[model samples]
Target: MAFRLTPQDTSFFSLFATSAGLLVDATRELTRLLEVQPSERNAVAERLRTLEHECDEATHELINKVNSSFITPFDREDIHNLAANLDDCMDHIEETADLIVLYRIGEFPSGMAEQFEILSRMSEITAEAMPRLRGLKDLPAYWIEINRLENQADKLHRKMLAELFNNSTDDAVHVIKMKGIIDGFENAADSFEKVAHTIEGIAVKES
Candidate 1:
């Protein structure tokens, strides 16, 4: 590890962990979309929106801390980028949940559960990794797992798209709505990978 002239401010790690914890909460709420009746979807979306707002607040706090601090845990730009990327993950998830309610989507395809499971796993591991940012210790495993999950998500996304297009009974409007939701979830997964990538960059630079 590179020598530091000043003791790192520990509060940044806590803020990062708080942001990641909200991600886990948001993804958990996403699972409710699969369980609830169509009428109940708006409630779930509302809950996710609330979580997203909380994440935004956390990001803002982190940024303000970065701006005011004389020294940071890492590069100021890296701290800014990490917070922005974490916020992006929440934004994508919230928007995806909102899409389902907006389109009044019903009976999510079975594959959506798999997607949710992958995202939940991603969020859980991300939250686990946040505290470790204090030392930039044992981070490679986190990014490696995120990359693997992302590849799995990519394959599943393509498979779901193919299946959606191949179904003969669904109407054009139905297919379009499902496609939008499918793409939305994929975007959320991609955002999580972006967070992992940002952390990996930080780890390499600090090492």
Candidate 2:
């Protein structure tokens, strides 16, 4: 039998997919922010801020639809959780970019490139998966890859922390700045994993 969604659910899926695309844009901006001049960082962050705002609006629309709809494509609770989780991912992505500008961090740690790389990959995986939620077909690969990336991110995060505290002779001030930036990156990675988990749960129940 084919899967079917009420028209409202289809609209929700479309909005969710749009938010996922925004996340991809945010991740790309983050990577670009890492490579650019310090003076240009603020401008890049501003663009991310705009994307984040759009994601926020999409999330609100999803929640409002859930509240108003008498029937949902999947479990209403799952729908709510998925929407919130996706927004959380976007929140962390925006926070990572905003903090970079606020802290005026000078050097990008070697480990940071790896973290953002994983984030970029996760965003692509997530953007792809959101639309697939409609049919719940062949989605195991999406969540599985996200889980693997989350594990990879954890290892890199630990390595970054070890380098941050162990090898640096910098003053307490520098440590504080770098720590904030690294924490943001770690949070973003963690949030992406949460998104994957929520999607997997929905897929499992539907299948």
Candidate 3:
């Protein structure tokens, strides 16, 4: 049997997944932008800014949904946590885009494009997982795959940062800024993994 839905549940999960989808789209765009030469950077940056604004609007809608709902599909705290985590994922995506513009990061660092690809893939996994909350019995296997992807993201992040710290010249500003951008990618993966965990919890709770 599946969990019963309320309008509140519908609203929350719809917006939650939409927010994640936008994050994935934004990151993918930024990754593609990073691959191009300087001539193509600004145009992608502008699109990313518009996408970020869309993400913010989606987030606010989610918060409003949470506030006005009478009861939620899960514990209020769990719902709140998941909503906030989704918002964090969106914010990190925006931050990564902003850094692409601020840093004028034309060409991607070695393997950086791969990391963005992984982030986009993981965010897709996460958005897919949220709906599985309604069918808790169906989630264990998917959560396992999501965990593996998150682990892959973790390993890739370590290598990406190692190169940044070791190969780049000793420019503190560069180090600090690149580190933050890299961290946003890491956090994006982490947030998606958390969603997997949240799904797992809902599975156990309902099963």
Candidate 4:
């Protein structure tokens, strides 16, 4: 545990928690993309876009707070990295939803729901972990679970790609579009892991 001689700004934790909570909301909207009719997908994408923008605002606020504050809970660089990575997670989720709408994808692959489910779990755990940054307690488990989930995402991604490519009926264009969406989800999952890794690094440095 790290001891601070001066009082550190604890609001950073609140901001981080808010940012992570938005990620959960964004992932939920992403999952809704799977449920809504194609005609209604645009609305869902728009909602995701809104969530992404809110995330951006939260990140910007965190950075601004960092710049102005004399004392922070952790290193400024780590704070910036963590905020950027959280934003990246939301960005990827929004981009994936946009692609689904832009590509006019009528049906999803079999494992897509599973992919979204993983991301949802990642976001949920991430939100849960943010408040713990105050003490940096019990953080290893958070990052460890994120790593495990990311591995699951990678394997599922490979399986999705193989299945997509193996399908003879899907046109080349269709395969390409599907690949883009799958890759986007994988990227989002990777972004979550990046957040976890950043948190882990902070824990190490502060411990």
Candidate 5:
């Protein structure tokens, strides 16, 4: 049987997906902003502020939805965890963007784009995982693939951090900047894993 979303759940999740989509767009925008000429640094900084506000508002609304609803499509704990995980993702992204703006980072690193690319893919995967909550029992197969993405994310995060520490100069600025970037990407991966964990929890209950 096809699982359906309640009107409330549908509204809540639509906002969730929308926020994730905005995060992807913001990531790309930040990438482009960093590539621009030094003279335009102020504009990129302003854009970061705007994106941060949007992310914060979206996250808070999602939390409110989780709190106010007496009934959820899944377990209350699962829903609460899901909301927190999603917020964590946005939090990391926004934090990193602010760091970039504060530093007025004029030059783009070569491999940073690749991490963002993987993160975007993972974001879409997480969104796909959300609607499946309503139909958890029907989709045992999904858990495997979702878990696969989580593994990929973990591997990529480790590799990226290793490269960051290995190849980058020993300057404190470089270390801090690279670590911030790596942490944001890694945390996004962790956020996706949290979603998987919620689904797994639901699966366990059903079984």
Candidate 6:
């Protein structure tokens, strides 16, 4: 293991883990929303809103901790960026759910279910990577898997857009609404990769 310049307030790792766990929960909620009754989606979206707020709080705590502590587990900038990226991921997840509820989107397109599955896998991989930050062990696998998932998401994203624009019979307004939701999912996946990139950088620097 590489030397970790941690403080007594090593709670940053715990906070990071908690934030990632919230992200996992949020993704699961989205998966459920995709499968459940249309009428039940709004309530599921509300749960996502609550989870997002909690994630925001966790990110804020990480920021405050970074500000107060003279020593951090990694570079202060890396910590802040990682925290922000995690929060951004959760934000996009929440926004996707919100749009579904707000737009009264009837059925989640079958293509989007695949996107949600990718998001869930990304979130799970990220949560697993969070604790590994303390030791910087076996992290290459984490980032590699994240990159693979992001690529899969990109392929799905392109297919969804192609299907929506070319073959769908839905009205322009409805297609536009779905485009926004798809954008959110794509953005969320990108954010996870960003976090992975940040961790990869920090690990290289620390090593």
TM-score order of candidates, best first?
4, 1, 6, 2, 3, 5
Q: Give the clash count for model 1.
A: 0
lDDT of 3 by residue, 1-207 (tens): 444565436667777678777877877786767667776777777777788788778877867777788877666667767777777776777677677677865456677777777877777777676666655556777779878988998888899889988898757887888788788778877877787787677667766
Q: What are the root-mean-square deviations of the candidates from the true structure over C-alphas?
A: 1.0, 1.7, 2.7, 0.7, 3.8, 1.4
Query: Looking at candidate 6, what is the lDDT of residue 21?
Result: 99
Give the alpha-carbon lDDT of every model: 0.92, 0.87, 0.74, 0.94, 0.66, 0.91
lDDT of 2 by residue, 1-207 (tens): 235555534798898899899989989998898779999999999999999899999999999998999878888899888888888888888887788788878888778878889999999989988878777888889989999999999898888989989999889988888888888888888888988888888877777
Preferred candidate (lDDT higher): 1 or 5: 1
Q: For residues 20-125, write the lDDT of model 5, one tens digit per residue.
A: 6666665666566546786675676567567667767877786787789876665666666766676677667667756666775655555567666666666666
The residue ranges of model 5 lying beyond 4 angstroms of the native Cα positions read: 1-10, 30-52, 137-143
Q: Which has the greatest TM-score?
A: 4
lDDT of 4: 0.94
Task: For candidate 4, write residues 1-207 as lDDT tens digits.
Answer: 877898888889998999999999998998898888999999999999899889999999999999999888888999999999999999999998899999999989989999999999999999999989999999999999999999999999999999998874888898899999999999999999999999999999999
- C-alpha-based local distance difference test score of model 5: 0.66
How many collisions between residues are there in candidate 3?
0
Greater TM-score among 3 and 4 belongs to 4
TM-score of each: 0.97, 0.95, 0.84, 0.98, 0.74, 0.96
What lDDT does candidate 2 reach at residue 197? 88
lDDT tens per residue, model 1, 114-205: 99999999999999999899888999999999999999999999999999998737899989888888898898889899999999999999
Residues 64-182, model 6: lDDT tens digits: 99999987887899989999999999999999889998999987775888898999999999999888888788999999999999999999999899888998899899999999988
Using lDDT as the measure, the top candidate is 4
